[model samples]
Structure formats: C-alpha cells, structure tokens
Target: MTATVPTSALNLVGKVFKPSELRFPAMPPLGLYIHLPWCVRKCPYCDFNSHLAPDSPLREVGTASVIPLKDARNPRDEAPLTHALPVDLQRRYLDALIADLDQQLPKVWGRKLHSVFIGGGTPSLFEPALIDELLGAVRARLGMPMSGEITMEANPGTFELARFEGYRQAGVSRLSIGVQSFSDSHLASLGRVHGGEQARAAVAAAVQLFDEVNLDLMYGLPGQGVEDALADVNMALGLGTTHLSLYQLTMEPNTLFAAHPPELPDDEVLSDIEDAVHARVAQAGFERYEVSAFCKPGHRCQHNLNYWGFGDYLGIGAGAHAKISYPNRIERETRHRNPQAYMDEMLAQARPAEVRSLTVQELPFEFMLNALRLIDGVPDAYFVERCGRPLSDLQGALKAALDKGLLDPKPGVLKATPLGLRFLNDLQSLFL
Candidate 1:
C-alpha cells in the first residue's frame, strides 16, 4: 500500500505551508451557514452528509452544564443552543459547533453578516427554542442587520403555528419548504414522509409569517413524465410563494439511488419538462434567475445569490464547508464530517478545519462558472470586484470560446449564447 499522507501535507495549494505563512483575508460581507445533520430517515436520492439512528448501545452525555462556548475575543457572545435528548436519543451536538465557531471568530471578528442560512437533513427537527437561541447568539456575536435575510430549510411534516411564529420572532425572515413534488407516487418514490396536503399546509404557515417564502421542488424523478413535472410546478405556483427552487434530480455517488440506479426519464422528456416549467413560471410573473430558481421581483434568495456571485461565507457544524476571500486569493475550508469526530477535535483545541488557497490561473474560470448561472450574465466589471482581476486576464481562452460562438460578442462582458448554455461543459472546458 502507498504510504499515508499527513493532513498538513494535503494543503489547499497542494504544498505544505509554515504556520507563519498561513493567513486568510478579512472575509467580505460575511454570512453564516449552519448544517443540521440528522434525519428521521435518509432519502434515497439525497447524498448530503446525513444519517439515521441505529440500534447502538446506551450513552448519556451532557455538554449543557459545560460553559457556553463564546468567541475567544468577545466573551459576551452567545451561540446556538441545542435541545436536550434522553440518553437513548441522538444528541444535537450544538456545543461542539459553537466551540468551533468561537475558535474561528478571531480571524473575522468585526465583519457584518449579509445572511444566515440553516440547512439540514431536516432543520425542523430541532426545537424552535433552539433556533431562537441560535439566532440570539448570532446577533450577540456577529452583529447582524436589523433586517438581514435569515433562511431555514424545513420539511412539510414538521410544522406547527407556534413553531413557525417562534422562528419569525427568532429573527428568521425567510423560509424554504422542501416540497419536492406534489404527486403521491413521486413523493413515495423519493421516500419523502409528507403528502401533497402537508406541503400546502406548510406553505400556508410559512406565508403567514415570513415575507419571503420559497418552495423547493424537484423534477426529472424516476418514472416522472413531462406533464407530471409541470403539474408539480403548477401546484407550487398556486400556493403563491414568492420564490421557487426547482431542481433536476441528480443521482450522486454514495446515494441509495446511485447504488441501485432507477429508471429515470429520458433526455427528451427531461428537456420537455424544463421548457414547460420555464415557460409557465415566466408567464406567471416569476422570472427564471438561476437555472433552477424562479422568483418574483426582488424575491431571489440573497444567500444563494451571494454564493453564485462568489461572496464569502462561514460554515459551521459537522460537514459544513466555507469559502473566504483574502487580499490576494480565496481560501476554502471544511469541518470534519463525523459529529463525534468534530466534537472530539474541538474539545481537544485542535483546528477542525483544512484550508486551501486558490491560484491566479483558476480564478477566471471559477468566476464565470458561477456568474454565468444567472439568466442575464453579470457585467464585465463584477469579475474584477469579486475575483480581483480583469476580463483581459483570460483573453486567450475567451477569444477561443468567442471564435467558437460559445460566448456573446458583448464587449467587456461574457454572456453564454443559447448553444453555449446548452453545452456549458464544452464552453467551460476551454477555460480549463
């Protein structure tokens, strides 16, 4: 067997760095990302780092009495609070996450957060009180805006008026309900617990409390026809949500569906569904901003927009990932995936992160990869603002792509033509 490489040997630059040389820039318009990694049951199509409880032996643990984790410099800062579970149930593991964030805050203490998103296996599984406490801690530590966007992803089955209201009162201004599809067969095939009616009720509750409500719908399911997918889109629009994120189902590695491949719709049917959904959504006053996202005026998800625009964000919790912009380059970091492993690493005072710095050669392609996702391509100047470079930086590759008619001839800006968007891989390959 090949000799094992040390963790430090696997630096982001593929080269080892001395401690003194390792520094990241003050992240830009920072945002917070919290991952909740537990689920009642795992979805076959979901490749997210999540797991269901197993028949394991007993273990009673209490980090509650332990001093609440605070930022190293700002001792007054509060963090997320977790629900207490009996010895038999799985723990929330919030203490470890708070400790991890505390250790990271010194690197970026005074930055103002643009958004905060709580995503998960099922974020609603956490008690509303825990969410309230978490947001309270965020405001105490990071100084969020009075009207900043706070979004949480939830499942339809886990809903109550009190909990929804608590989330609003806790400072959450947006809600993204995971209503993958309205068809019972589609929902069942995806192993989703909620039915069609449950999705409706969940949207109703969210609309009542949050100013921005988004529905997460999935298309191109196993055995799903174009008409079936269109029906799902129509049903979601009827709910009157401000935003909708319709994703084409992808069979990612390690997912149950990948291991046992299902009979998915052919490319023709998939294309039909995409065309139908796009037309219907446009006619209903919703504009297709991102490839899979549709929104009313000013209703786009700011957090996702930041991501696509290559903005900075801090990710916390097991399996969370983050990207930060520094003076000369961008750095990517990831937390340990295992809950137990993350806690152990945090409790030992060792950094539970791995970092990488990007090179000049990689920046242009990276910027275009994200910016081109918008329906209307970004202005030429945004490249410099975000990537800290100019459009002329990648002239050779741009000229090649332009000669191939893959890019529009719009001076100072790069826009993908219809053919380019269809074969984006080929267009992007030129940059690579």
Candidate 2:
C-alpha cells in the first residue's frame, strides 16, 4: 500500500522527481514479476531462465529422464529445445506481454501494485485463456493490481492439473505448486515430469482451486534420507496448504546437476535433513518467514514480502529481473534472455533492456542482500524506507554485526542472529 506522499517532496501523482543521491521516505510497496519463460522438462537441477517449450509435447518426454546420478547413464545430456515457436506462441507472447507492460508504465508511475509474482520456466506452462489474457492485461494496466496478490507458478504436469480450475477463473489469486519432491524416486531423480501420483494430484487440485495455496518443497535429494526429508515435510503438511517454499538441493552452475554430480545428502545427512525440516515446519503451525519461506500466519509472501522488504519490482518476461525505485536512484532492469530474443526486441518497439544505476558502492550490499533474508530482519524503518541510505549507513557494519553475535541486538530490528541465521553467507558478507 505504501504511498501516502510527500517524503519531503520527491513528487508523486503530481510528478516531479529526478535528482539523485538517496532520501526517499515513503514509496516502497510495489510488486509484479511475471516471467513465464516456458518449461516442459528442463530440470536436471534447474538453472531457471527456463526454456524447453518450442511446442510442448513435454518435448518428447525428456526421453524418460533419470539423472539422480551417482554414476552416469546416457540421456545424451539433454538440454536443447527452443526452435522457432511462433505460430502465435501464446498470442505472440501475450502481445509482447502487454507491450512489456507499456514499457514498464513510466517506471511505475503513481504506484500501487503490492504483489503479482507469476514466476516461470513453467508458469503453469501458460493457458488459462493465456492466464485470462494476462490478468486482463494486468487489470488494464495496473489499476490496483488485480485487486492485489495474483501469483501463479504451477507444475505437476498432468495437463497441468487441468489448468487449476482455469487458474482460478483466470485471476489466479495465488497457486505456486511445484511440489519438488513427493518421491517417485525423488521424482525420477529430480528430472521431474510429475510422479508420486502427479504430486498428489497436483496438491489435490491445487487445494480445491486456490485461495492462497503454495507448496514447493525440496531438500537434498538423490536418494534422500532423514525420513526422506520428513516424508517431504509430512506430505506437505497433509495438503490443505497456505504456503511453504522450502528449497535446498543445490548444484547450480550451468546445471544438469552441475554436469552429473548428484549423490546428495551427506553433510551428516544434510544436517539431519535441515534439522528435520525445520522442526517439522515448527510443529505444523509454520511461520519461518523467509529464507525459503514458510507460512500460515496470515500467509506471508506478498510477492516475497515485496522482495524481503526492499520493495518495488516490475520484471515482465523472458529473463525478467527488475528492481526499480526513485526519489533519487536505484534501478536494475534485465529482459532479453532469448524467448525469440525477447519476442524480437520487444515486438520491435526496441527496448530489450539492460539499465543499471545502484552504486553508492552498490547500495549497502544491495540492502543486506534482501534485508538479511529475513527471519525477522527489517524495520529500523526499512533503512530510511527502502535504502535511501542512512541507518547510519551501516555504522561500521552495524558495529561488526553487533560484535559478531551476528546481529539482532534487536531494539529496532535488522535481525539474523541464530548465529546470523547460521552464517547466512557470513551474515551477508557483512554488508559487503
């Protein structure tokens, strides 16, 4: 919701910004990611910018993929699918995603989105009437973001569970469902094309057709243990989900399980399967909020808490990645990661993106790399309301992260000290 206005006049709804060096006091809430990059079967430990659908017949069914490799067996290292898919590829990629949302609606003019997500390489492999004509072209250009929280990510593959009740009548008010492990041999050793009765009948028809449902589990597989990762978190907390993201399997660098490396679960059984799936998702009430999220307490994930509270997102499609912010500076952009070269340079309106502008030596290590992956960290007035600097600009890395207890000397809250969420990459490189 965030826009009350006049943070000492950086203009809004009367428009008058542009003059940098940070100071915005209000204006952080916007969100809306999108990226439906396509994916029928590209999961040898996916490296994400997903692409196999040239015309998804689940692309020759991954030639029956099986890579949970402790030793290799030929599949000819699969990866190779994209080849001219435009016989109106989903209505020319939904009119180049509503002209790339009218070229990012004047950098989010008069903001109010508050959450949309729709993430990819498998945004339910598109078609709930092209996600109801892309959420009715984002409610005809952001007039209150489809009345808040749209979500979308689906993947259980049996004709994508009949497009989840037409993606909740095409408004998709949250669905997630990537069920990354219910185990049909860890879904054919992670090449996944649905198994374990199509991830329990796509989470029982997406928890009876969406009302905030999410389930994307995973935890050091390739013959998992620790009760097969707490029986995939007690069968995703016996279904009726509210939200849970839980990822853990790693091998990423150009994928195919980093060129055949899967024999996982051995750092003492992946730390007792991440301490028994984080104490069985906190004994089934669930609330770990961020750092692979967990919900069911007014269900967090308002587009990843507007990206761990740094807020502002725009993203769009094919390799999308936005950040946006103003009343001084902040930027990020991206686009063009080949979906027919971002629909041939954004339907020839020509703006395949790149952007830039963050540097104040990279905004306090990109605002604690998303506010210390929050278990609670944030609200020391979200560092002058979303990094317009000065929480004493990380006062000597917040007194060496509060003298290396690693942070959360509380009092105002920037959090992380369960030994800094277990050395969260040495507490986010101590603000770099």
Q: Pick the candidate with the highest lDDT.
A: 2
What shift in Å separates residue 183 of candidate 2 from its native position after superposition? Answer: 18
TM-score of each: 0.83, 0.35
Q: Which ten-residue region of model 2 has the weakest summed lDDT?
A: 71-80
Output the number of the TM-score-best candidate.
1
Which tens-of-lDDT digit does each residue in 1-432 have in candidate 2? 232323542322223323335767676878888887877667777888988877544433233246443212112243312221333686888789888889889888878887788888777666677778888888778865634678888777533555688888877778888888877777777767666766787787788877888888889887788898898888888877888888888988987677777677788888888888988988899888777888888877677867877788888888898888887888888988888889878888777569888876677778888878888777665766676766666778888988989888867677788888888888788788
Q: Per-residue CA lDDT of candidate 1, range 267-300, in tens?
A: 9999998888888899999987777789998888
- Each prediction's whole-model lDDT (CA): 0.72, 0.75
In terms of TM-score, how similar is model 1 to the real structure?
0.83
Model 2 segments more than 4 A misplaced: 1-24, 29-34, 42-54, 57-80, 103-107, 110-119, 122-188, 192-219, 224-268, 272-306, 315-379, 383-407, 410-412, 419-432
Residue 226's lDDT in candidate 1:
82
Backbone clashes in model 2, listed as residue pairs: none
